[model samples]
Target: MKIANQISMKEIAKLCDVSVATVSRVINNNGRFSEETRKKVLDTIEKYQYNTNTVAKALRMKKSNTIGIIVPDISNEFFSTIVHGVESFFFEKGFSTIICNTGKSKEKEKVYLKTLDSKMVDGLICISGQEEIEASLLSRNIPIVTMDRRPKMTNNLAIIESDHSQGGYLATKHLIEKGCKNIIILTKKNRLSPDIDRMEGYKEALTEYGIPFTLQSIVETTDHPKGNFEAAREAIRQELESGRTFDGVFATNDWIALGVVKALSDFGKKVPDDVKVVGFDDITIVKYIETPLTTIRHDVEKLAEVTSKLFYQLLTEKDVLIKQKHIKIPVELIARKTT
Candidate 1:
């Protein structure tokens, strides 16, 4: 069959000696066709190297078989694990995933959201950094599934997050049970939902034990590698210089906890002996560290799976999804050599 710059269904139908309707039915797999006729139409399509315009198909169907996922940092083990789960689930359902890394920046998040929207993604899964952007997302009326963080403004949004407050409380309580009285929570000052909830949990544990909570004990740092390490080192140095003794330490995330471990090791302090350490997220790095870290584990992969399922339900079964709001996943404490 001779091919033109633009191949139409008519040309394909003529080559197959069939009506255009038969060709259309074969192309869409709509309305039944015999195996032999379907084979002939497909053979003609392949011979002419015909490609259906997906954009037009999507316009007609009112859907694009694509979903967008936005995370704070793709390189982080927690986010990467979640992405792996989401990708696996969606790919099996014949959907493609578009990944966007916000790098913990609000502007970058906005840009990516807009870009994904422009690309006409069917749905979005956001692991948000900024709580303030929830209103903007809600206004767009796009079905959004949030992981690890929940938006403050809307109750209609679907959220999938680990029980972070319980995780913090469990971590602190474990350290205290190890005979550590003076404990400090090293975390960021930002009022992000997860941080705030974890801080509350830390304080709750202290209050239950009748231990005095002091603002001085909370060492806040920028959520970056250099800044977090500097904060950990400086906090340890300052405590030592001031003759203040701390027997237990809770770093909000594993990255900071690893830094704390390094600082303590440099200062000749033995983990779970001189001082007990506990971290969150239980990132892969913590397990293989010099002092295998005892940390709170958030089921990031499960979170992603549930989030993807919710989004799929929303896109496919709309009325049934109306009641969905917050989905709280559980956390676990993995005890290792650190504590």
Candidate 2:
């Protein structure tokens, strides 16, 4: 007759001949109770096989207690660190997290965003590479926080990012100070603002230091690990074939930097001895390489924490004025064996 299924907390309370409050207190271990009453409550509960409705409790709170994070690539250590930060913060607040990797595709990003929205997540943290989604769509109903990549058209979205321009300037200036005359920079074409700004900073450093800037030194490639490695190898081969010498190289990201290091090794060119190298985003693997990389370090964890706080504030606080907030975290250069 499915007696256990038919039984409930109320039925247990009735069976124990105790008030609901006493039964609930004993069950939750909240209030003091006589040993006799506690025993009776436990026996009744076990006999009934009563289960609490956690879903109903969450519904009453009007929140799913979950935050959705959308990132470009999970395989990258940079994104993984950011996820750690988000998870740490949300877990402390008794909230759960869901991570989605979009593989830097705008179509996939859009699909994930819509899917997470349908799942009724309390808030969303997006790290997007594209700027096609409308600002109105982001600002209309839900709270969305952007990390690493900023939305191009929106001032209404909250953005947490590192100072890429400063990082670039520092990296180029460091190379220049180390007596690198002919420097080459490898980056992606039509990059995001951070990349563009970094390139501008690199150019400015060269101009400031009286080094002649050449467009021929700029190499653009598709933004992928394999593509970057091939580009780095090709650039070195071309330079050698043309009988040209470059004293230093700067890559926009750490993966690209690692690729350049491999290319240089293959070509019998020593790092910091023959050609100094600098990379952005101090990914973990760089530290353990044959030549510890000299790279720009961003506080990815702090960015995630701030992003989570912003989402929570937007969701919890009524009459919250959403502003175009650009929070720029600092970047530092870690001098390693490479430089």
Q: After best superposition, candidate 2 residue 29: deviation in angstroms?
A: 38
Once all C-alphas are superposed, what RMSD does model 2 give against the true structure?
Answer: 10.3
1-339 in candidate 2: lDDT tens per residue? 347757767877888898888877665444577878877877665555635333323323446777788888887787788788888888988888889898888878878776665455677777755755544333125566787676665433577888888898999999998889888888877687788878987998999999888898787765445666676666666666777778898888887788778877877988989999999998888899889999999987677777778777776786588564778888999999888
Off by over 4 Å in 2: 1-62, 134-140, 153-156, 223-227, 322-324
Model 1 TM-score relative to the real fold: 0.80
Candidate 1: where is the Cα deviation over 4 Å?
1-52, 134-140, 153-156, 223-227, 322-324
Model 2 clashing residue pairs (backbone):
none
List all candidate RMSDs to the true structure.
8.4, 10.3
How many residue pairs collide in each prediction?
0, 0
Q: How far in Å is the alpha carbon of 225 misplaced in model 1?
A: 6.0
Question: All candidates' lDDT scores?
Answer: 0.78, 0.76
